[model samples]
Target: MIDDKLKEKVQMLICGDLEAGEKAQVELLINESSELQSYYKSSKLSWDNLDNLAGIEPSKSFVTDFWKKADKEKNKGFRFFDFFKFNWKLAGSFAVFFVASAFFINNYFSDVNSGFTFSEDVEILNQLDNAITLNSDSSLEVYGPW
Candidate 1:
């Protein structure tokens, strides 16, 4: 575990903010401890290297170009119902299908021999008689004469 006091003094020493007495104490500790010596060397090297990297000013058009590209990307993102622009064509096709189906159904049902009829065919009447029976009182009341 690192000693917090020593660490603080080392950081102040690296940043050139330690007083003369504190700097002497920290130097003594650093010289005695191999870990403190290594830490001090690395921290000072990093600090000196950072000083060599001077800040560069961006070009005049950089901000405007950045905003234009950002605006284009924002516009391209998360559009709802974008594919629905062609839905009118789908609606037209569905209308045509329903009209054709209704036309066929109407013509089919309108034919003379199309739907159910009370037939005079004995075999069909016998089949119907076998399948149905006037068993319940409610059925009799509905089907029977008053």
Candidate 2:
């Protein structure tokens, strides 16, 4: 468990913002605590070495170069639809085929159901011939004046 006073100093030390008294306190805490010592050593190593990284200096164009590379890599990222366009075309063609099939089936059933009407010409002709023959076959006569 880190003490409150030591915690404040540790934060200042890591941030490189420790005052003289804070630095003394941070040193004492680090000397007494293994955890604090480890944290301090790592912080010191990184902070102290950062200034001497191969004596390397950044150019004025570093920021522009960083942005250019970042933008290029971001644009190179795969878009969601680029790999699935062929599937989309296949699905579209399937939908069109399904719709046309439905239309043809509806027309075919409608023609069979509604366009096939009953034809009465043959039955009517047969009935008319029977009536003429029955009228002509009256064997008996009328009792009164013909």
Candidate 3:
């Protein structure tokens, strides 16, 4: 991997900003290392291509137009939640979903039996009450202090 120091040195070498000694050292390093040699070659090719490209001359109003657009955007305050603006359609759909789900659940359960007849339910309640009374009486006798 190319290190930050080596990358900076390579950039400086490409830009012709390195001193004579630094340039010589970078050149030697590039010559000795295949990775550095490839990196330098690609960098030099890209820089040469960029230099040879013809520059586009912008219209005189380009700067003014750009600033005007920037100012307009700046004047319109930015909010992170603006992208998540609530839609009434979405809310209505969610409401419809919940209502439909509730209706389905109610209809499903309404058809199911209570699993116990009325008389059976009354008998079970009575048995439960008797069991609770017996338990309380036994606990009192067992835990009573002398």
User: What are the models' TM-scores?
Assistant: 0.36, 0.27, 0.36
lDDT of each: 0.81, 0.77, 0.87
User: Where does candidate 3 clash, by residue pair?
Assistant: none
Highest-scoring model, lDDT: 3
lDDT tens per residue, model 2, 18-48: 8888688778878998988887677668778
Badly placed stretches (over 4 Å) of model 3 are 51-53, 56-146
User: Per-residue lDDT of 27-122 in model 3, one digit per residue for the tens?
Assistant: 999999999999988988887888888989999999999999999988889775453367767767877999999999887676556666668878
Clash counts for the predictions, in order = 0, 0, 0
Local accuracy of candidate 1 as per-residue lDDT tens digits, 1-146: 56887787899998799899988988998999899998888888887898889999999999999999999988897764554457988767877999999999887677646554446456688877766763454567876686
TM-score of 1: 0.36
Give the lDDT of residue 45 in candidate 2: 85
Candidate 1 segments whose C-alpha is farther than 4 A from its true place: 51-54, 61-146
Q: How does model 2 fare in lDDT?
A: 0.77
Question: How should the candidates be ordered by lDDT, best one leading?
Answer: 3, 1, 2
